[model samples]
Target chain A: MYPTKYHKPASIEDAIAALGGGDDAMVLAGGQTLLATMKQHLASPSDLVDIRAIEGLSGIAVRGGSLTIGAATTHAEVAGSGDVREQCAALAALASGIGDPAVRNMGTIGGSIANNDPAADYPAALLALGATIITNKREIAADDFFTGLFTTALDEGEIIVAVNVSAPTKAAYAKFDQPASRFALVGVFVANGASGVRVAVTGAGEDGVFRHAGLEAALSADWSGSAVDGVDVAADGLMSDMHAGADYRANLIKVMAKRAVSASA
Target chain B: MTKVNMNVNGKAVSGDVPDETLLSQFLRETLRLTGTHIGCDTSQCGACVVHVNGQAVKSCSTLAVSLDGADVMTIEGLANGELHPMQAAFNDNHGLQCGFCTPGMIMSGVDMVARYKAEGKDLTSDAIRAELEGNICRCTGYHNIVKSIEDAAAKM
Candidate 1:
């Protein structure tokens, strides 16, 4: 890692101000992804604003028909949270399944979503559950939050405060984990809520986490795994890597989507 | 340089190191506590696992400066001049071959047992194997390691 200045901010306002001081300043939540990237020389921020000391950025609460999780809340907390398990078991399961126990103890939901890794698990859940990304600057809906691979709509110096996800009537996530990293080789999150049925696919999209409109439409009409049986996910515009080809990922998307729907049911 | 003060193995230590210094570096270089090994610096290997505020975390991926005032327990702290229960179990069960991943595996196992005990869950063989995902043992093929953890869980 390169030489960098570290600032521990006690409040969100101070964090933002510290970030503004350096053009290449980056916010450090759990330091799971950022630290690894820095170690690999992929990223070198001039300043690191450590926001873990900030009081209000780490917690989970259900309020007004939505489950609000602080951005700094660790995956372990979410995985073990009774409120989350009761309100959104799929979210809890997804949190528990990320990486390993040690990683889960350190990785934060905010960091995971903000990094917007294409193989990450949270984006699919956020997109399917129609969560709201609440940042210090503004509230962005999940639909507009993730822009592309390892990208988001967050602006420079913008710090995510919390995420508010409306409780779905039924929701579940199924993932085919890559053996080594445990990241989602292909993951699908299916949800049925007030808005309608939503199916989000992660780790398989060429651009990034995207909703499967075909599966969503079919499931919306039938609300069953068989509804998506005939729907074929296109291999074009899907990710292909050493672990899986685009066609294999397309098959995984269907299989995972079916599993998620069955689990939801 | 960043000034950091934290409790390590029940000892309050202070250091002024570069902001980019990892917790593993601080423990190995500054404090001379080499028990916390760095097998894979990419955070995939659990050789650098340690307890920060009673939770197992990858020290290689954690910044030392960020842990100011926190309580850290490395493998060296697992016992007080005597073998801890988990360490004894490993020895009795021949859990290690190369012994490179022993410290991390033991730390993670102890932590897993603690967490399971708190949750009132049994530390079954399946649970031990599942929780040992982070710690990679290339030599042992994890057969003895899993047995060691299961043995330790029983006594712990």
Candidate 2:
């Protein structure tokens, strides 16, 4: 690991200032991924603006018809928050299932979405639930927030303030675990929210998390598990490795989607 | 170097170390608290689990500088005058083989029991196993580990 400077800013402005010029400066939220990446020498940031301790950056609240999870809020908080459970139990469940207990205790929703790991569970839920990522600079819809594998619309020095979502009428996430890593082999998030029915898949896509228009249309029309059974999921652009072939992943997509619809219903 | 302060193991401790120093490195090297073992430092193996403020977090992956002015409780802090209930339970149940992962397993077990009890949720054996997902015993000695957690849950 390379020696770098660390700053624990008291406010968002201080954090952004600490992330000066932002090319090699990174905001350290939870540090679950960033610190580990640094240890492996895969990332050598010039400075890390520690955001988890910032007063307003860690919380869970439900106001009006929305649930806003602060960017620095840990996964354990989301998994255990009564407000989160009441507003979106599926989101809580998804948070609870990420990594192991220690990982959840340190990993944050902001960090999770920012890294945008291909097998991560948050992107699918955020996309299917139509979440709005509230950042210090601007608000980006989940649809536009995620661009591709390990990529997002975020620019340097842009700190994610919170993730806001309108409480869904019905929502559930079904994921097939990769076992060793506990990452999703093929996960599906099904929801009936403000945007009507939206279905998203994670872990299987070569381009990262993606919304399934076909499954969404089917679920919007029929709203049942059996409605997803006949949907054809092509393996053309999916991920294939020693863990699972793209063809197998395509089949699991439908299976998990059906399970998600069944759970949500 | 980064100057950090913390109340570790019920004592006020501070250090000036490299900015990139991990919590596990600080505990083992600077503080000479080798009980918090580091296995698979990539954050997969939970051998370095410790309590930051109150929750269990992987020390191997957590930066020491980020925890300035925080309270850190490690396996060494678990027992005050006598053995902690979880440690005793691990002993009674023979929950370890190589014992390299024992500190983390015990820390995670204690935290899991506290959380479940606070939530008014039952600490079933299945729940214990699920909660231990982060801490891996490469020896695959999970059966007794689960039993130890259940036993400690009852005693705690």
Candidate 3:
């Protein structure tokens, strides 16, 4: 059974205080993934700090060609926001396509990225868009933020306040979704050469979501589907599961990168 | 336990609830609003669907403490005594059989229709079906659910 004392903090300071109380405290944002994990007894926190009520923590804003999204902003808001749909259609599309409606409505970008499910979609967008995760303490680049499967650079007691993404000139995400779960079997996000064509692959990597340097380099040369053609990805660190093998995932990296490049073009 | 205060169906309600208590449990157990059902403990199932601040959310995945100062609208509050247009259409189009999933399905359906109406866009069957994908029903195969939402669109 889930064990926790629910605490609603009026401020970020209070929320952090709860986290530092020497208990296994989990920060609850949308709780779309966290609660489900709790229900399955995958996690048993001594305290749950609910931060949704904390003011000034949920919104979307575009300033100076950078999109600053509050950590608590739900997927539904991101997908349906007028600014997001117009300025970053690819991001909106990715948000809209994440799990079914309930998940979209309750799942936040911070929670999803923090959970770092191998098949999640946000990590690709974060890596490709060159987003900076703003926490209570500091800002970390997306490249350095994600460490491994279900791990991040975030230290305990640090809460993600917002995500600031330097808007891409053009971008697109394409994913081969697992039918039942709707999680990506192979998801790819490609941005234009302004950022030198960063390509982040999810669902196929053993490390959860990671940038494909080879594909990025190839696409930097030519921003087209043919750029990554015949360029094989190394299967050394690809995930092998009931869904697909390591070699198949490696192959899919190339295919998905090519498709993303073409779609963005 | 946490003391929670929120607007439910446009009325303010306050109560003390446990941190481990899901919004679904609060609505069904404490408040005794049984319209919202819990089909799965996981967030994957939308049987416990409810409107938290005007958006359809999985009640099972949310905590009452998180919604302390938010606005919530459950399936119980969808209509004013009489059935909403979506409810009427669901009945007319045979949108349900087992009826276990009807409450959640109808709540999501009405929310989608309201959202589209606010945007001044006509609701299409595809759009309605896409939004309702969060809600699942074991019966009717979703054939009539789609038809009911479409029919409800016209009536609205």
Among the numbered candidates, top TM-score falls to 1
Count of residue pairs whose backbone atoms collide, per candidate: 0, 0, 0
Query: Candidate 2 on B1-156: residue-level lDDT in tens?
Result: 878899999999988999889999999999999999999957888989999999899999888888888899999999979999999999999999899999999999999999999999999998898998889898956999999999999999
Per-residue alpha-carbon lDDT of candidate 1 for residues B62-98, written as tens digits (9 for 90 to 100):
9999999999999988897889999999999999998
State the lDDT at A44 in candidate 3.
Answer: 93
lDDT of 2 by residue, A1-265 (tens): 8978888889988998889855689888888788888888999999888887678888988899799999989888999899988889999999999999899988999999999999999999999999999999999999999999999999977899999999999999999999998999999999997789999999999999999888988888998989988788899889999999999999999999988888883
Q: How many Å off is the CA of B118 in candidate 1?
A: 0.7
Candidate ordering by DockQ (highest first) = 1, 2, 3
Q: For residues B1-156, what per-residue lDDT tens digits would candidate 3 score against the true structure? A: 678898888888888887688898888888888999988666665788888878888888887877778899998787888998988999999999989888888888878888889989878778887787778888779889999999988887
Residue-level lDDT for A36 in candidate 2: 82
**lDDT (Cα, tens digit) per residue for candidate 3, span A1-265:** 5658877788999999988883698888888778888899999989888787788789999987778889899898999988887777889999999998778877899888888888899998998888899999999999999899999999989999999987787789999888778899999999873466788999988888998888888878878888788576899988998988988888888888877777773
Q: By DockQ thresholds, what CAPRI class is model 2?
A: high
**What's every prediction's RMSD, in angstroms?**
0.9, 1.2, 1.8
TM-score of model 3 (CA atoms): 0.95
Model 1 has an lDDT value of 0.93
Q: What is the TM-score of each candidate against the true structure?
A: 0.99, 0.98, 0.95
The true-versus-predicted C-alpha distance at residue B70 of model 3, in Å, is: 3.6
After superposition, the stretches of candidate 3 with alpha carbons farther than 4 Å from their true spots are B10-12
In model 3, which residue pairs have backbone atoms overlapping below 3 Å?
none
Residue pairs in candidate 1 whose N, alpha carbon or C atoms collide under 3 angstroms: none
Models ranked on TM-score: 1, 2, 3
